[model samples]
Target: MAATRACLVALVVALTFLFMEGRVTAEPTSAGSLVQRRREMGSLLRRLNKPPIASIQSPDGDVIDCVHISKQPAFDHPLLKNHTIQMRPSYNPRGMHHDSNITTHAITQIWHQNGTCPENTIPIRRTKEEDLLRASSIRRFGKKMPRSIPHLNPTNDTDTPNILRGHQHAVASAQYDKCYGTKSTFNLWKPWIARGNDFSLTQFWITGGSYNGNNLNTIEAGWQVYPNLYSDSNTRLFIYWTRDAYQSTGCYNLLCSGFIQTSNQITIGGSISPMSTYGGTQYDIDILVWKDQAGGNWWLQVGGDYVGYWPSSIFSYLADSASTIMWGGEVFSPDAGQTSTHMGSGHFPNEGFGKASHIKNIQVVDSSNCLNPTSDVGFITEQNNCYNVQSDTYGDWGTYIYYGGPGNNHNCP
Candidate 1:
């Protein structure tokens, strides 16, 4: 009888803790705990939402703040306190020309329909109080869990370890003696997500160091539809970096202070418009990341604009050059079982173009700072039945990969 009473008390304490953290509704939280949580959230919002010289309300309900480049969040880091922002890359990779024979489609953000941010200012998506409320906690906001990146060259093509961690991927990777940069065009889609906590994304990873240790350095840029992170299901452009394998020291977009923004035209977390429909007109975005050998900063170029860069001083291994480059789609399910969340365009890679999502013209920058087509490419995925990847080469497209699928289907479940 005494043991039963102790268990009941412990359960009650656990319930109270969850309630106070807004993780569960099993019990009502105390007034003091709720007020304290509110205070903490307010303080975080104030720090993130810097004063803006001008603000534009996006059609999709996002407020784009034109913050002065000098006052942006990148300067908040102690390492960057005395850093100077490089307006442009010292040297672009040689042979970085596009094929005139390949037809191009235009892509723009929903916020652009209103107005663009002024020159000498960068557009930042304002974070709201509700955004904080969606997170499991204030500390975990805008951060990916540790080991979020896929394994580098898994021994087996199955990659069962990643599946056990609730992360799925269909990616093409390249490993070289030294990799200075990579570029590709990713097909865009608003794939369905099973839960608010689940996310679907298409991106590329620039990685160095060992994944086994905490020294993994990675710089990532992509479009993701993450409802829990943004408080909505809209697809948004995002960038992330970590010197320590996501254990700490990085965040999505400008939530943290490592990446310096230089582009006035593009908003890091703004919603992307005109998603591709099944068997219809397709829209894609060109993402390019290259290291400036002179300044040692890794620069990010979206289409034609130089978005910003991850300063070389922030990384140990990546301060020199990347060892591997990966491009593909990933889906996250918080549950132990399979989730219904879709990856890529929510269709199998066998469906081909116009139906399946793909990344084309995959290339890598060599030691000589010249962009060349990737050779000896490989693909990996956790579950082949649920999601798969295929690589091929063709005219104008050069090297490309088709990937993604609907999750929790008959074979997947």
Candidate 2:
């Protein structure tokens, strides 16, 4: 405990000295030096050591899990530091990642305004329509529209096309190992150099026996070509959820009543486009999503960028915690007879890196709110012919899974 505390202090001191100039360095000195590395490590250890506090049910029949944490987010890249320092227009948890500029007024003022939350409790920052129209072009048209950007990879004649058999998934063991947490992490590969109108993505989800069971919360990211989805056909990070099963409300991303986008770091469909290379260069995207057990909000992050969150007011069972957490590849082919686009990397999970696509370094927030490794992994797919999934843990690759497929093929035939 002493060592962890010292490390946390060292990390903060070092960063404070570097960015103290107020100029965000090209690449943080923290990532370049061994001392900086250890400092970062110390911060991570400190956070993991702290146990999670108990949660409660709000008067609105929602679960409020905003536990108190004295320590601020110690592991964020310098880029996220300044961004998180602002006063979120919505619900703000006690310890939700903030930088050195953090102050008592950051969230207290907003929390104080809400008479709903109990003493010491921070209510979920429910998103208003004004909040919804803030970050998106959807506000311009007054509603959600589709984009024409396609997720198809730019390919060479010599490039090999994926001939997947069926849809596949290499999901972490959430139920089998009885795993539970507020957040999860994985290294996701942006599947490139592929074809098809289908879709491929990796995300976090919690579900009961049925979608309408006790709870079902899904947060997804990847590439897709859907007419019913965005205003375009390009691949993009998409989110979907259902509190009372699909029987009633709950829609994708900010469609209905749930998620709120606070950052312009990612332009929804722009910024990072899908690649079309195979062995030449592979771009793996990092995904991190955690339910602010304290604030009752689901957070989404990619790489060093903190995108936004899904507030607790959007759920019932998920208002507190989830029963199952799934992270893997899934493809959507609207027509059963039409399987085309790709999921994850265009290659199968067995392809490893530089070739096939895969997800690595999987971790989940335990009941204590600390990130922990799962006990095992499980694979599943509707049809083994059109797409498939597999996993490996070798070298820098942590717990990873690869899955994709080519639709209407003999393998699935």
> Which predicted model would earn the best TM-score?
1
Write model 1 residue lDDT over 54-146, tens digit each, in one string.
999998989999999999999999899999889999999987647568667888999999998999899999998668766766777899988
Candidate 1 residues lying further than 4 Å off, grouped into runs, are 1-28, 153-160
Global lDDT scores for all candidate models: 0.86, 0.43
Q: Tell how far residue 410 is off in model 2, in angstroms.
A: 2.3
Best by lDDT: 1
State the weakest 10-residue window (summed lDDT) of model 1: 22-31
Going through the candidates in the order shown, the clash numbers are 0, 37
The TM-score of predicted model 2 comes to: 0.54
